[model samples]
Target: MAAEIRTFTCLTDNFGYLIHDPATKATASVDAPEAGPIIRALEREGWTLTDILITHHHGDHVGGVAELKQRYGCRVVAPHDKSTKIANVDLRVVNADVIKVGSLLARVVETPGHTLDHVSYVFDAEKVVFAADTLFSIGCGRVFEGNYPMMWDSLLKLRALPDDFRLYCGHEYTASNVKFALTVEPDNPALKARAEEVARLRAENKPTVPTLLGDEKKANVFLRADEPSVAARLHMKGADPAQIFGELRERKNKS
Candidate 1:
């Protein structure tokens, strides 16, 4: 059976994920944004957290790690880079590493851009990816520690995943991402439709996540830098995809 995932809001806009394997009754939290909510969620589900996975060392992502580890005695798994600065990591993982969560498996994919040590976990059997801050529903993370080319490459790595794969990102930024994406491809019908859908979801206080990769390919301007329509809209028909992606990132930063 596939792992069951539960998502809850953490902090201001961050999201915390709890993934449980029913067969083995093992559970894991993707990031520890806050301890109170995550502890409450685990208690509500009657699941004991066996592992805590860290994508990067950002404070919001690891703020509650120590507390959660103390409370649940969970193993901490994080990136292998020395620069990450995360504490109490029992296991250090790099690109292509496979992590075992009971009977389920999560393959790590290095997705640097948001941070040089950023990594995403792909559960092939479940067709789901916990992308953290690297790839959001309609927008990618800012190039805070890496360059535009690095960010573009990271997005492409995610874009190359199976179209049926569902993406679970770190934040609830879809509504704003939709608005910014429109400035790059205003005439894109798919984007326009997605904007409407996002608006409706937000109005109802619903999550707009676990979105299909196929939908993102159609509507996310950041991932469509190579598309003719996007290129034409940016007036860079023959420009390299990375260059177009850089310009779009810059525009989004200003927006």
Candidate 2:
């Protein structure tokens, strides 16, 4: 059976996602941004938390793990690098690890950019990915712990996924990301249209996430560094894609 996904705002712009598989009555929280919202979400849905999946050790992502574990006895799964720092981690995973949440399965893909230990989860059967901070709607995470080359390779791993996959990132930064993206590729029709749509959504206080990978491939400047048009627009035509990506990341940092 297909998983049922519920997304809600947590701690300002962070998003918390709950995936439930009715077949096995298994429920998983993608990230515990905070305890109140997650606990409330579980109560409202009448679903018991069977698992808590951590994308990284960022406080905003794992801050509520202890509380949730105490409340639901949920098993905590996190990346191996910083698993020790995250409280109550029952399973430490690495790249290519497959985790089972009852009848649902998620494939872990280590993506080191925002943090060297960051990982994204992909549910192949559902064509959905919990990308956390690695890849966003119109932007990618800042290269804090890793270099541009590392971030670029990590992004390529995600960009290579099936175009139809749906991406659920860590934050609601699409409005700002689109603004920065326009500065990089102003003449891109797809981006311009998406910006307008994002503006409309934000105007109505709507969430602008769970964006389609196909749409991102066309509009996200960070993901388009390998495209000739994006490179040419930056006056870096014929430059290596990784170099273009590095320059873009540098510019975004100052933006």
Clashes of each: 0, 0
The residue-level lDDT of candidate 1 at 240 comes to: 93
For residue 155, give model 1's deviation from the true position in Å.
Answer: 0.7
- C-alpha lDDT of all candidate models, in order: 0.93, 0.93
lDDT of 1 by residue, 1-255 (tens): 778999999999999999999999999999899899999999999999999999998999999999999988899999999777787789999999999999989999999989999999999999999999999999989889999899999999999999999999999999999999988888889899999999999999999998999999999999999988888888999999999999999998899
Best by TM-score: 1
**Model 2 C-alpha lDDT versus the unseen true structure:** 0.93
Among residues 3 or more apart in sequence or in different chains, the pairs in candidate 2 whose N, CA or C atoms overlap within 3 Å are none
**Model 2: residues with Cα > 4 Å off, grouped in runs:** none
Q: How close is candidate 2 to the true structure, as a TM-score?
A: 0.98
* TM-scores of all candidate predictions against the true structure: 0.98, 0.98
Question: Candidate 1 — which residues are off by over 4 angstroms?
Answer: none
Query: Which whole-number lDDT from 0 to 100 does residue 179 have in model 1?
Result: 90
